[model samples]
Target: MNYELRLYLDQLTAKSASIELNSTYARAIYIVEGSIAIKNGVSTRLTLSQNSALSIPESFSLGGGSADAIMLRWELVNEVDNSNKIQASQSTLLLAAKMALGDLSQYIIRCDRVDFPPEGEALTHRHLGGGIRCLLFGSIQIHTLGNIHTHQPLSAWFEAGPDAVYAATDKTLASAFARVMILPRGLIGGKTSIEYVNSEDKNKPKSQRYQIFIDELIQH
Candidate 1:
C-alpha cells in the first residue's frame, strides 16, 4: 500500500531541468501536454508525448523539452499481503482484482486520459479491471450500483471491480486521467476491456459511441 503522487506543471522547460528518482516500486509517467525524455540507464531512453503514458519497473531519470510540459507521476509498491485491504469508496471495489491476482502475479498496467465534452454523457458501461482515477480538470460524477459521487480537480478515486457506470458529473466538460493495472483476462489485444449494457443507441452518433471513446483513450 505504499504509493506516491507527484504533480509537475510547466516545470520541465529546458534540458537541464532533469530530475533523478530512485524507488523500489513501479512508476508510471503521464504526459498531460508536451513531451519528455526518460533515461533509465545507458542506451535506454524513452520519449513520451501528449495523451500518452509509460510505466517503468524501478528507478529512472526524466526531463522535459524546450517548451514547458505538464506531467503526473505515480510510484506504487506492490504489497501482496495488503492486496485484499484496498482503500476506496463503498461504490467501487478498486482492488478486488488485485487481490485475486496477487497469487498469480500476472497483470498488465495501462494508463491514459479520458475527456468528456460539455453535456457529454456515456451509456452505462463496466470495465473488466479495477483502477484508480484522478480528476485533472473540471468536475466528474460517477454512478455505480445506485451510488453517485461528484469529484473535483486534483481529487482521486478508485474504480473497484468492473461493473459500474461512469459519466460526466454535470453539464460542463470534464477530463480524468487514470492508471489501471489488471489481470490479462481484463484485456486481450485489439479487444475492448469494457462491457456496455446498452450497446445499441441509434440516437447516439458513432463518434460518441462508448466503445469508441474508450478505444481512443486506450490507443492514445
Candidate 2:
C-alpha cells in the first residue's frame, strides 16, 4: 500500500519529563543522546541508552529519565490515515513525503549506518528504493539531480532511489550518517541496494563501510 514516510528529531529535557507519541504507523527510534524510559500502555516500562535502537508498532510513550535525551524517529503512514494526522508532540518533523510503495508485502524497512573515511568519495550510483537520511557526525557533500548540498551533523535530506547520486566526505574527518530506507524484500539478508553507474567503479577500492541495524520484511 502507498504510504508517507516521516522523520522526526525529538528532544527531551529534565528527568521524569515524558511525552506521548500515539501513532498507528510503524516506527523506528534511535537514541542519539542520554537515556530514556519507554512505557507501553498502562504498564511495561523499558529503558534505552544512547546509541540504542528500538522498533515498535502501534503506539507508546518515551521520556527522558536521566538528564536530557535526543531521539531520531522514522515512521511510515498509510494514505487512508491522512484524516488522522500526526500531532507533533515535542518533536521536530525533519521530512515527510509520499512513498510509491504500491504494496508493502514485498517491501522491507531497513535502517543502516554508512561511514566514509576522510576525503572519501562515493562514485556515481543509484539505489533500489528511496528514503530519508540524517548525518550523524562530520560532514558530507551530496550531488544529485543537478543539485549539490553539504550537510552537517543532524542535517537531513531525501534520497531518490532511481536518481544518480555522488557523495564526498569531509577532508579532515570521517563522515557518517544513519538512514532508514524502504527497499525490496529480496534484499533482506544483508544484500546491498546500491548499483554503480559505471561498472569499472565497482572494481575500484571502496572506502566506505556499512552497519545494518534493522531489516524487517513488511508483514501483510
Candidate 3:
C-alpha cells in the first residue's frame, strides 16, 4: 500500500506536558535537545538524552527537563488524509514524501547519524531507500539534480533513493546531520545502504563516520 512519510520538530515546555501521536503509524523519536522521560500505559518509562532515539507505535507524552525540550519525530502514515493531522501544540512539519512502500514485511525503519570532520566529503553516491535529513550542526552542501544546495543547522532536505548525489561539509569546522531512512529488511544491523556511483571510487578514502540510533522492522 502507498503511505506518506513525515518528519517533525516538536518542542515541550516542561514536565507534565504532552504531545499527541498517531498510534496507528510507526514512529521514530529522536531527542534533539534537553531531555525527556517516556512513560506508557504499562509503566514502561524510558529517558532519552541528546542524540538518543527509539522506534515505537505509541507516544505517552514527553516532559521534564531544565528548559524546553525538543525532539525530531518520524511518522509513517498509511493514509494521505491522516498525513497532515496536526496538534495545536505538537510540531512543525519539516518535510513529507509519498511512498509506495512495496511490502511491509520487506522494509525496516532506521535512524542514524552521519558525522563529518572539517573538510569532509561524501562522494557521489546513491542510497537504496528514500528518506529525509535534518542538519544537526555546522553546514553542508548537497549536489543533486545538477544543482548544489546549502543547508544550515535545523534545515531539512529530501533524497530520493537511486539519484546520484555528493555532499561536502564545512571546510573550517566539523559538521553533522541526523537522518531517518526506510531501508530494506536485509540491512538490519548492517550499513550497506550507500552505493558509490563510480566503481573506482569505491577504493577512495572516506571522511564520514556513522552511528546508528535505531533500526527496526517496519510495522503496518
Candidate 4:
C-alpha cells in the first residue's frame, strides 16, 4: 500500500498566475481559499474556497489564474509500482465527496472526511469493537467506559491492546469538526469489527449489528 499521502498549501494573490505541465504524474488539488482559472488546452476557471480541490494529470499542459486564494494539493506518487491502486487521475477538480478511500478488499478500513458545525457534537457511543481513527481536522472528546478522552487536532486512537474497551459521551460542546479516517488493523491475536446505527432508528438492537455493519462498510 502507498503510505505517502501529503497535503500542500499554496496562497496566491496575483492574477493570471499559472504553471506548466508536459509530463505525466497523478495529483489532486483543493482550493482551500480563493478562486482560480485552470487551463490545459483551454481555460477552465474555478472559483473555489475552503476545502475545494483539483486533480491534475502529468501529461497535460497546465496553467491557471489566482484571485487571492490558498489551495490544498494531494498527489499520488509511484504510479508504476502501484498501478492497481490508481483510479483518480491528475487534472480533475474535486470536492469533498470526490475524496475517498480506494480498494478495501484486502483490508478492513473506512475513512471519512466528516464535518461538524460549531456547537455540534458527534453523539454518545462506544468503540466497543476494534479500530483506529485519525483526526485530520478539528477536535473531539471521546468517552471510554464513562471516562473522558479529549483529543485535539491531529490526534489518533487505536484498538490493538487488551485495554481497548471505550466509548464517548453524548454531551457535545464544540464547533465544526470532522473525523478524517477510521481504520481497523489486522490484529495479531484479536477480534475486529466496526458498527454504526442511526440513533433515530428504534428497530435495531444496539451493538448486535456491528459485524454486519462493518461488512457493509467495505462495500462502499
| Tens-digit per-residue lDDT, 92-136, candidate 4 | 222111123345333333222444444344333334333334343
Show pairs that collide, candidate 3. none
lDDT of 3 by residue, 1-220 (tens): 8887788887776674554444745678788888877777666777888889988866565665555678888887775556335564666888888877787879898899999999999999999998889999999999998999999988899898889999999999899999988899999986679999999999999999998988888776
CA error at residue 37 for candidate 2, angstroms: 1.5
Candidate 1 weakest ten by summed lDDT: 211-220
- What is the Cα-based lDDT of residue 55 in candidate 4? 46
Worst 10 residues of 2 by lDDT: 79-88
Candidates in order, TM-scores: namely 0.65, 0.90, 0.93, 0.42
For model 1, residues 79-143, the per-residue Cα lDDT tens digits are 43232211232012222223234422344455656666666565677767666666667677778
> What is the overall TM-score of model 3 with all chains considered together?
0.93
Q: Identify the runs in model 4 with alpha carbons over 4 angstroms from their true place.
A: 1-3, 21-26, 42-51, 58-66, 79-113, 123-220
Clashing pairs in 2: 1-103
**Top-TM-score candidate index:** 3
